[model samples]
Target: MDFTDHVVVGVDGSSTSIAAAVWARDIARAGHWPLGIVYTQGMAPDVREMLGEGGTLMCVESTLAPALVQASRTAAMVVMASRGQGSTVLPIVDAAAEAVLQEAAGPVVVLPYTTWNTLDRPLVLGLDAERPSPASIRFAVSVAGRTGARLKVIVDDKGQGPDRARLQTVQVLTRVLGSDLPETFDVEVSAHELTDALLAKASEASLTVVGSQHARRSTERERSENRLLLRLSTSPVAVVANTVEAGQADGSATR
Candidate 1:
């Protein structure tokens, strides 16, 4: 259960699952972390061959959601396909992925089947100007540092001036990241809705990170927006659990 230095991915033999495995492999390779594969249904032999040697394989008896939830406890990050083999619909995340997003204890990356090649692209962080999550910020910074990608922080604010937006973002970043902030980073404040802003930027990003208050029940609107981004974003979407307390900096601005 201790996967602190591993990039864990859930595989179900679907094309999307295979793609998620590949993405996890690349991330593990970049960070010099081991790759852990968890299979609840079953894993394809081809997937094993594709991954090659030295990856840990886990076969769980429970469902995908429970297995992933347990793995997320100490895993560096848990990766899953937006939709599995049971789903044929477009623009909708599968049940297991949605459940994991709502309950996973750590960061979860949901990769859609249409995920674009993200090499050398910027890492997009969708920040809530009002209530930024420290956990989200640290994860984004760590990933950007490992991949040598520019960290682009997108803040969704209506009626706020660009200068004010930048100031607020900087204050939050400084408070959370301190001297660990990436050397190359920029802030973008948009008046558009959070989903719209992230969608526009995701087209050119390697990965888009959003904070969610997974410890508590999320509003229906919040769930809808997260699903929309997971379904339509051009890149893999990381749903990091916001550890901030409720009512005070709950990190809902990006939700």
Candidate 2:
């Protein structure tokens, strides 16, 4: 199915979910696309009023993961709160969010309960120089272009020289973006761990994007890293799946 029509957000009547819905609404509005709110049960009247029009509300009998996965099949992207409904005192990624991130056909955005103070910050991207995903790079550039936001690409050196890491990043970006690169973007090679570097960058960013390989299932280490990133990121984190397989050429942007 073509995935370029609507922005779908999963809500559970919680304030966190409502915040995510509002974020999704703004994205839909900006892109001139329709918005979809998927919930399992009844939603509050005030919440519905806040969301307003140019969207559809869908109630699914199943759990949040299945509902979001079904909606993501045709959506440009799927969004959800980092923690929802029965969250505990300790901050952790909700089960449903984790499941959807792993199984969703398209990108999955996880919004934290804490709201960002401003929208002028750059769009941060955590890129792996050794195994860069063209889909992720294209998605970040597309969002940066549409929002008129600067793009900050972060790469971990992993003991390599900063110059070499930056060079690798530039090569991958040039190949992926070609002439369609964002007007303002810079590559930052960090010596710290990937998760730590992203956390620091996300604190001052409007949004942070990372890539997840589209596979049968994620390894334990990958799952742990994803959970850590989602649990601590100060801004909304977008986990874009690398739809293009290894040894295959990159295709057009899905969004």
Candidate 3:
């Protein structure tokens, strides 16, 4: 089926996958977008059993690789559960979720199964302290603008260049969004570790925003930071890739 501009969710019958599907459903409903539930070909029977009913089955060779590629090609945004039910930690970005953040061409939202009131907290955007990506900021701004939600921009200066990083971040947002940046949006520069700082802020946030990694080309530190943020955040984390323009958003083909 054609899934253009739709919200696509990857499901393996795990609790996390179900949570992702539910979250995607709410988002699609809120945005008046279509929703597609995707299931890989060789997942376990229990995973299949969770289907219970009919939905578009995006049969693929691998769960994260092929499925995400297809989702990126046809979907506007892909939703994934950070970790499944078997995870030892309460929340962690599984290997599949990591691959999605690294490779997805569009926006990806990684969520945990934990419960929280999305309406009460503000939307938090975690800026890259080294080189902030304009796409990431713009995407977050778009969401906050649409939802009329308060936005918090978090920059972990730590030992990195806080002044330079903060300047670049504000410039990009102001350049890309101009006066469109929400009046409720605020920027915060911190000296704490990137992951640690974001976790603390996200604990009370409704949703956290982050940029995508450069897939195979990303450094170990880049990949680890994104993974840690996804795994540890108490709020839903949105990972926006630099593939499509922030305005012309949505996902997958293959590589």
Candidate 4:
């Protein structure tokens, strides 16, 4: 199958997984990109019924990481439900889903089964003041643009004072967005823990964007925080690669 720009979603028979598939369908339709529904083991009959027509459907009996890696080889972005089939009550991040986000070469969007509706909220971007990633910023902005939502950028203090953190975030935003920074874009520096601050602000967000902390050289603490955020987020989370791929694709890179 031609996988260029395809929206690939992983399904595991959960309602949240179906929601992810539906969201991916909308994204694929909007962008004129093909959609691919991937499942290993089994799929819900209702999910098959809900995913009526168009796009490619692949079923494999392999494990999660291998399946996700194979999907990543072809997919521009991988979408997965935050929780798995066995999850009940709250949807916490599972090992299989974490593996996908950790190793996926491209972007991975995690859809959570939140009780609270988040369809009309703003988009939140998590910026690492010590080392801001342009790709994450660009991706967040692009998504906010598409969703017609305001963009709120949050800077992780990581031990810096509020004033210093704000300056660092402003510098990174200026460097990445230039004069094109939308009037709806807002940036703030937070004194709370990265995950805590993001989650606290997530109530006002339909989606949150953060840099992928899965690289080999990333500190254990950073990786752990990212994973924790993935697990506990009430809003959808888009984990973008740290490279400037999004800026390059949109011809907005200052580099």
Candidate 5:
């Protein structure tokens, strides 16, 4: 759909969770999308209280869901986090979110339940020499579109920037429902070092998306840059798993 669509945010009711909720509210408002707050109970007492016998599971979900609907452009199930483990570390949060916001996967801005942290905005998707997962791009685009946030894809790849490979990725994005592919999308080209350029852009953007290179196959250098992004970038980070085409063995796309 459009950026006016809704975004699904995960919370844990912890201070961090609350912060996530608040952050989601702001994003929703900016993007003109309804905010969805889901409280995870992967921990304990929290989920138990919500689902334990003589618990308030039904009552709570009913009350919170509708109330959220009222106060927010639209609110949804505010249940305790569930119990599980899978593709993600926070399986509970992931599962609960997948259930409530299926087909509504515009973007899932995860606000970790870590204390003493500020939520960042104006998401910056780091364009790697290696292409990002199509699914990840789809998710990122949805959030960017909804928030009316500007997108800056960093092409830190060497060689000719994988011209052919990147072109296909670009082609797919153009077809997506919400893509503001301006003539030039904050393009960047770096030979080796990317600290200065990345820091500069990260400083301005609210978020950054980095392809999560698996250690099993990553070179010492690739691993180093990924770590650098985590430590250097000032904005919140979204680590996307590798999903580039075989042709683009190196991160760069040469058109």
Candidate 6:
């Protein structure tokens, strides 16, 4: 796919998910970029019965999938909130994030919620961990253009794991933004303090962009818990995975 103009989002069977879908679609349309959504139900027969008739949940594929595709360069994905967010401050990413963070081959944007922090403040794409893919940069650029929000490239502790990664990440970011990304992009090198740093910046920003770790989820419980913590935070979140949500076209389910 032409990732240079694609945007993806993760959705669960939650009520708030709809808002995220709508918001993502709106932004995608505004930017004229391809938008995609993903929803995953895993191998749980009970979940399949709970979400659908067969052993797999079809609500997402049949319901909200289409809308996502039509929205510029966008797609939708739905996974079991396998890990959902955790209850702690540094919770893990649920099933949805695991799939996106690990499998999404592009700069993925992990959004916790779709509709929030619509304030007219500056928008910052937090690159605390993993290098962004083409998708991530496209999402950030599209978001900034659509919202008219000043975009900042944020470097949190996650991006500074080792000296090599830190330097390489900064170099990548610099290449991504070129003259657009000013030298003032906030650099937070503290460990667990990333949450605080992000939250503090969120207070002054219209929104913050991040990636999901669930895509790399190895354990169900751990991933679920982290997603919960992220969901509970003050900032809105976006989760990206390798899958897409085709059911969104019918506009029947949430994102």
Clashes per candidate (backbone, < 3 Å): 0, 0, 7, 0, 20, 77
* TM-scores of the candidates in the order shown: 0.88, 0.87, 0.76, 0.79, 0.48, 0.48
Candidate 2 residue 139 C-alpha distance from true site, Å = 1.3
TM-score of structure candidate 2: 0.87
Best by lDDT: 1
Q: Write the per-residue lDDT of candidate 2 for residues 1-255, one digit (tens) a residue.
A: 233456788888778888898888886665456778887676745557888766687776767788888777667678899888887746567677777877777677889878673447888999988877676787777666655668899999988889999888888888887787655688888999878999988878888888766632655213566678888788998877788231111122323
Better of 1 and 2 by TM-score: 1
Give Cα-based local distance difference scores for all models.
0.76, 0.74, 0.67, 0.70, 0.41, 0.44
* Deviation of model 1 at 132, angstroms: 1.2
Regions more than 4 Å wrong, model 4: 27-33, 41-48, 87-91, 113-115, 156-164, 178-183, 213-222, 247-255
Which regions of candidate 2 fall more than 4 Å away from where they truly are?
1-4, 220-222, 244-255
lDDT of 4 by residue, 193-218 (tens): 77889989877887788885434233
How should the candidates be ordered by lDDT, best one leading?
1, 2, 4, 3, 6, 5
> CA shift at 3, candidate 5, in angstroms?
16
Better of 2 and 3 by TM-score: 2
Instruction: Write one digit per residue (lDDT tens) for candidate 3, span 139-183.
Output: 777666655568888887666577876776677677767866666
TM-score of 6: 0.48
